[model samples]
Target: MKREIVLLAMFTMAIIFMAGCKQHGTPKPRGYYRIAFPEHDYKPFNKKSPYTFDLPVYTEVGDGAQPQTREKYWYNINYPNLNGILHISYKAVDNNLNEMLEDSRKLAYKHSVKADAIAERLFISADKNVYGTLFDIKGDAASPVQFYLTDSVRNFVRGSLYFNSVPNKDSLAPVIDFVKTDIVHLMETFEWKEMPKL
Candidate 1:
């Protein structure tokens, strides 16, 4: 009877070992958190400013030239929900159009080390006399978008998009695309303010 009890215990142990060795497939890849995007509705920003454009209603326009000296028309489109900001700076053309254009190009290329590619798309509105180039940067660059709108004679406005968090192109792709559309809308509605007589 004792011998039979020992054999039964061994058999049970063997069955448990066989059950633990069943096939297990490879581990699944990690995933990122889902982001909730707001509606794409926008409103005209035709306030008492040097220029006017349409911006998303979800954002706020604030002075970007503060803490140094508040310049004439330097502002930022703040995206509180997405932790991002679009810095816009206006410069009056005073025989420095070439230099200004060069500066804008250099600024966009600064991220070439980290960016996989930089695409420049020309924008022109003959009726509005708006002309500019939009820079769409790919990869893990700090700033994914930079653009400049100019009348090519008297007004030059440069804008750049930056995030408050770490640079992760893959994770930020959706937000970047959404903001890109808004930026394009802004360029479409952009108009330069007439300079006062000197």
Candidate 2:
């Protein structure tokens, strides 16, 4: 009788274990953490510089120009909370307009290897006399947005957005889109300052 009771208990335990091991349905895919974005309130960045634009109230501008390599007008629009920076460089066109445009195109395309697609939008402001192109890069590229604004004359400005962390488009998409709107606002309010004659 003890032997039979032991067998029944073992059988019951085995059935319970098998039932526990059976899955209910298909497993859901992995998910990432949620991101919180700030409001889009902006303030004018009209410092004593070669150009002026509207930057997000949450951002701070720093000198991006290095003593060794970068020019005087290079600046970085830093998003501290978002961990991203938009490097803006200014160059005066003495006659190298074509070369400058070519270089801008090349710099933007360098990410094409990792980028899924690059969409170019031509920006022409007849009132502001600003003519240039904005490059929106899709995918896991290091720099997902790059643009160059020129009067097609004297002032040429190139800006590229980069994050401090690893390039994960899926995770950074919200941040990128948020910053992109700020950039668009910058572009809309962008104006060239009159450079002093050297």
The ten-residue window of minimal lDDT in model 1 covers 189-198
- lDDT per residue for candidate 2 within 1-198, as digits (tens), equals 999999999999999999988967888986877877788999888666778888789988899889898577788999998889999998889899999999999999999999999999989898998988999999999999999999988899999999999999998999999999998888889988877553
- How would you encode candidate 1's per-residue C-alpha lDDT over 1-198 as one tens digit per residue? 999999999999999888877856789886777889888999988555667898899999988787767567888999999999999998888999999999999999999999999999999998888999999999999999999999989888999999998999888999999999999999998987776442
Question: What's the TM-score of each model vs. the native?
Answer: 0.89, 0.91
Model 2 segments more than 4 A misplaced: 24-30
Which candidate number has the best TM-score?
2
